[model samples]
Target: MGSSARLRQFVHDNGPLILDGGLATELEAQGAKLQGDPLWSARLLHTNPQAIRDAHSRFLLSGADIIATVTYQASIPGFIRHLDVSAERARELLMSGVHLAKETVTRFDSGHQRPLVAGSVGPYGAFLRDGSEYTGAYAAEMSVEELKVWHRPQIDCLAAAGADLIAFETIPSIKEAEAVVELLREFPDTTAWLSFSCKDGKCISDGSLFTEAVQVARRSTQLLAVGVNCCPPDVVEPLLDSAASLQSPDMSWVVYPNSGEDWNPERGWKTSEKLSATIPELSHTWLKQGAALIGGCCRIGPALIAQLRRELKGDCTPAASAEPS
Candidate 1:
């Protein structure tokens, strides 16, 4: 079976799925910067593919069953930031991510365990933090025509890249989400999983809750699944609480939350706690609360993932203990 088929089976049998952590932080740590161009966040794609690959390997070692490709900020205008990463170049980056993610498993999986490679399509913004700003402020109306022109190359690339499934993450508004969802409608052979990001109140910048977001994504072609990302873990419980009872006849509930609270852009974020422990605790709670899939957003990394693997291997401390008390 192809990798995506295998992962599809994995999701079906496990019911609950697990994905990897952020890539930009790891890349930045390895020497990525916002040179002059400010659009394409994956500026290091051609010049620093190894850095991206290294980040994926780290997540795999941390026990991630799936790792997303590094095309999050690879839009055309976004690509023009560093060098001229044309739309075709953007396509190459997406495919390259799949190749590297798959290779990581082959290279490091000592026994027979290997993770799935998922292609990640971030919002219309930069990364997660500045991601929200990408919506509303950009051209009025999101412009489906513009999106079709902008996203076609990337979509074709992902479909041809053998990604397990396209993960559309950190979307702040419904229009932006719908535009991509519309693209998925054209590609019946490929499946997509859309995850949105919200403000403090659990409402999307477009003012929809997880319910509305899920509904929109569901209509966008039986999307493999739908959920939230880049929001706080504290909000995860509440959002799950709000959506848990609402049965989706078609879609699965996936939640990829941030390690801690949202960072304040004004003074910047400073967490008093250690991520080594906090992030796993947060994910543990998410898993117990019926989240069909779980992962981390900004700042969370391999160490947190390792903690989760340790906890999962040991029975996850009993569902009762994992409950947010």
Candidate 2:
């Protein structure tokens, strides 16, 4: 079956599709250092591919129905700078992310529901590694066409590499979303989900209203779902409320918030004691609000994904937290 059909069928057979938790978070837990790397976990694609595969395997075993590849930061320009390789080799590295995830899923399939592989395409700001992703402050001179050009190869490479769907995730602006939707036309058969980073319940990180962002995103025929990611859990429900009034009934919604913490470009992530909502609790609430694809972003690991699976399936059995001893 095609990817859209498979997704609909899976949602009908099960509840909301369970996406894997943070790939890089679990990778760091596995002892692969990611500090100061432009490619982040994508660097592991060259240094230790098995680690990426193992992260996918853990999420699958944790009951994730969809596995997003580790290409979130694997842009061609970033690869060239980090790996010191040609553009051709950079694209190869991006394709390798899909291959590693696919290979893992192939080995883990035991005749149950097959998990969909989502090729991750992060924002242009991510390539900068300067925290502009959360702020959407690209160089003022960067034009929409330039954004399209910068993203075209990654999207084309992912589609050509045989991903089931494109995960245009953590998008901080409507311009980038439009660029991706336009680039996707070159590959008619490919479908994508465009999820954004928001500053509040109603506004994206760039200070654009979610209402406006969703309106722009819903114009794309290639988009299977549209919503928020890497935003605070406290803001998701209100963001969903803002989007509910704007989204079409046929359009699915995706929500994968970070652990309600702060990310400093120079110092990395820091926890906040004031944040009380746990991932599993917020996940149930997001589902009730119409999130068809649910998972976690940074700081969320396999154990929490397993918890979400149990919560969604109505399994009350308790499970261990992120760091099980």
Candidate 3:
């Protein structure tokens, strides 16, 4: 079977496929200072690639079925502007994100199923580094064609680097979702999944209805899955429930929410006193709701991934429990 087909089949035979936790979260736990860097974790691709490799290795060992490359904020223009590198060199850095993940997968002896590498394609607001990704306020100003133009080079490099699939994650608006779905036609063989960054149970970050966003994603046959990401965990079930009837059978619901904490652009993640449901507990409900691809986003670490694996697989082996830094 082809890689895309394998992904579908895995979900069919197994339950929801376990995706890796936050790359930046793990990197910070390992002592990488990323605050104020426009490139975010992508900067480490040029500065400390081994750190990237090591982070991927940890998730694999923690039982992630798929690990996304650290290219969430990587773009040719961003690299040129921030890293002061030429376009060619910037492209190389983008491709290296995939290479590092592939290399990590190659070296790991999991002795089980091989994990897939997903090329991370974060929203344009991520490149802006102004917290617009959460609001999707920028999408209103950009046309679909213009968004495609900005996203083209990164998509081209990721596909060229041989990612198992593209992960168009944390998209905040239906417009950007439409642009990405349309862009998938250019890479006919590349299968991808589009996940939105939602504000509540029913709406995405731009205040667009999540149901409408899923409809936009449905326009692309190349998209193997569609759902929400980087949003609070509490909202995922209702989002899926509201759009349940609209979901296509062939397209799975891919949900990987954050730790149910709120984000403050100026102060970063706000501390919460209210305890929230763990991923494993919530995942059971998501699986029942037909979420086939599941994992974590911000503040989710390898330890939680390991715990999730054990919970879903019913393994009794002890796993790491260190909280994310």
Candidate 4:
């Protein structure tokens, strides 16, 4: 079956798809020094690929139905400029991210369900290596076509590498989301999901209403799901609530929020007081709100993902605090 059909079938058989938790977070826990690196976890695609594979394996063991590849900050230009490799080699590295995740899935024994690999395509602001990804300030300066041009190469490489789907995640603006949705036309066979970095219950990072942002998903028939990621867990319900009436019946809501902690560009993730509700608690609410795909983001590790799987399977017996232990 094609990717779109495969995803629909999975969601039909499964109540809600379980995505893996943070990749970079798990990698750091495994001893990969990613601080201040432009490549972030993508650098490991070349430096320590085994670390990336190990991370994927852990999420799989934790019961993730889908494991996204470590390409969220990877791009041809960024790799060439930072890793100092030729353009061809950079593309190879981008493809390697998908290969690593696929390798892990092929070796795992998940009983009746086969896990999928999503090639992560982060926003253009991520390429800036600044906090623009959260603020989306760069979207104001770049045209939709320019954003599409910047993202085309990475999407091409990921699709060619045989990723099950393209994860256009952490998009902070409507303009970039439009660019990505339109760019999907280039790869007629590829299916993807676009998730925004929300600033609140109602708006994306660029201050555009999420209801408006999700409209872009309607432009592409190939988009499997659309929702928010990397934002605090508290904001997800409101965001989804705000867009609930506007959503298409066929479009699924895919949400994987952070552990309710704030991010500091200079200082990294700032620890917040523990949330009253655990990820599974919040995810249960999200499931009621129509979220078809669920997981965690920053600071959410494999242990938490395992908790999420248990909670989703009706094993809710008061999981430990959602705070990453």
Candidate 5:
């Protein structure tokens, strides 16, 4: 089946999904930079929009069924706070992120069809300088009143750009997911899915149990799928089990774990140092359990996505070719 049809069917059958991440980190590492700037993406957004689209194309070519656009770091608050860009410019960058996806898809998949665009919605705040922890992540600053004021413009920008579906990712808390859902509700035409970041097994960054986040999301949002991203691959097992324990296996669980082995701010999270091991060679075992949707976080690129495609769908031998454990 075509990618869109396959994705819709995958959602319908509650089958395995292969979604991709790592574009922003990849682009920034390549030539694009996000240093000391929240809206750090704007400088490279339109000029290097293709860099992200290329990452998407790489994933699609590698067998990823879903391609998350390069909007994870493209948040309004981050832009206003860090980039210090005007509202008009921020909106332009956000729309450009969406449009770049379309441009890439049209160019690469014109005749061949098999990849869906997932408009990425990242944290409202920012990741810590160390990269080991997520920092400044608040969906709302004060009351629901305060939250709405913060999220409106960015949410509207993604909707206007015509995202197939919203991918609210890397949320370490339920409140943030709720905030995103609440913002989405304002627009009758928009649809969204929630994904959380699990710390240990039980709680979010704020210490709310993963179940608390999942249950509230299930009850409150019109989330199409729910799972975790941006954590370590090792964390996947417990996070999935936690969700399943909550009686939510029927709903698809999306996963994109960091390939890194160790994450320390001062030590740095260089791509080479991170994924010291090959994925799915070990990860697909989780696929046997749950993990309908899977991909990589920081430092992961086309090769890993390709391996996932082969392991999950085709006849590629994973354990044999992978480096010794």
Candidate 6:
């Protein structure tokens, strides 16, 4: 079967596939200083790639079926502007994100089912590094074609570098989703999943309805799944209900919400103690709501992923815990 078909079949045979959580979160917990880094976790592709590989391995050992790469902030233009790297070098760094993930998966693939490597193509606001990703305000001046232009090189590098698929994650607008769907035609064989960053139960970060966003994603033949991420877990079931009306049967709903933390560009994550719950306890509710690809986001670590695996699969094997640095 094709990779996309295999993913769907995996969800059908087993329960929902478990996606790995928070690449930057895990990396920061492992002593990587991401604060004020222009490229965020993508900076490790240059200074400490082994750390990136180790992050991927921790998720694998924790029973993640898919590991998203450290390319969330690895756009070529952003690299050129921030790091003063040549376009060629920027492309190499983007490709390195996939290679590190694939290499990590290979190293950790014992006798178990191998995990898929997903190249994370984060929203354009991530490159801005001004918290616009959560509000979609940075993209207000951009057109869909302009968005496509900005995303092309990163998507191009990831696709050429042999990621199992691309993850257009944390998108906050329908225009961005339209651009991603249109960009998919550039690489006919590469499958992708479009996940939005919602602001509330009914709307995306841009205040547009998620139903409209899902409707835009549904236009893509290369899309394997569509849903929300990096949002509050409390809002996922309602968003899923809205997305359900627009998605086809073959398309799965991928949900990996944050630990109810609010991000401040200057101060970083501020957790909500009242909303804090173990991901395992929350995964059951997410699964009940028909989330086919479940996981965590910001402030969620390997221990939570291991707990989810144990709860869902009955495997209590411990993995490397990513303690806060």
What's each prediction's TM-score? 0.82, 0.92, 0.95, 0.95, 0.82, 0.94
lDDT of each: 0.64, 0.83, 0.88, 0.88, 0.64, 0.84
Tell me each candidate's RMSD, in Å, in order.
6.1, 3.3, 2.9, 3.9, 5.7, 2.6
Q: How well does model 6 score by local distance difference test?
A: 0.84
Tens digit per residue, CA lDDT, model 6, 1-325: 6666876776687767788888899989989999898888888888889888788888877788889999998889877887788999989988999998887776663455667888999999998889888889877799999999999999999999999999999998888888899999999879889899999999999999988888888787678888889988889878888766676778878888888888899999886765547567767877776777888888888778878887877876444333211
The TM-score that candidate 5 achieves is 0.82
Ten-residue region with minimum lDDT total, candidate 4? 316-325
Candidate 4 Cα outliers beyond 4 Å, as residue runs? 315-325
Look at candidate 1 and give me any clashing residue pairs. 37-81, 39-78, 40-78
In lDDT terms, how accurate is model 3? Answer: 0.88
Q: Per-residue lDDT for 1-325 in model 1, tens only? A: 6433554566777645567776665655556773333533366566667777678767766667778887877665555444565766655665776777666666664342356677877665553244354243452555866766666767777778787678888777777777888888777777778777766545765666766766677675447677787776666667766666664545666777766644654444456454335656666676676556677766667766666666554432111111111
Question: What's the TM for model 6?
Answer: 0.94
State the lDDT at 237 in candidate 2: 91
* Model 2: worst 10 consecutive residues (lDDT sum): 316-325
Candidate 5: deviation at residue 67, Å?
1.3
Model 4, range 1-325, lDDT digits (tens) per residue?
8768777777878858889999999999989999899889999999999888889888887878899999999999988999899999999999999998888888777564678999999998887878888989998898999998999999999999999999999999999999999999999899889999988899999999999998888888898899999998889999999988977767899999988887877899887768524788888899998888999888899888888988887543222212121
Query: Per-residue lDDT of 11-117 in model 5, one digit per residue for the tens?
Result: 65634667775776666656776555544454467456656666666666666667777776676655556667787887888877778776665655423334566
lDDT minimum window of 10 residues, candidate 3:
316-325
Task: In angstroms, give how far residue 184 of model 1 lies from its true place.
Answer: 0.5
- 1-325 in candidate 2: lDDT tens per residue? 7655655556666658888888999999999899788788899988999888888888887878889999998888888887899989988988998898888777775345677899999999998889999988883557879999999889888988999899999999878877787888878888889999999888998888998888888787667789988987889999998777776655788888888889999999897745424777877778877888888888878788888888887653222222111
lDDT (Cα, tens digit) per residue for candidate 3, span 55-97: 8888887888899999999999999999999999999999999
Q: List the residue pairs that clash in candidate 3.
A: none
Give the per-residue Cα lDDT of candidate 4 at 2. Answer: 79
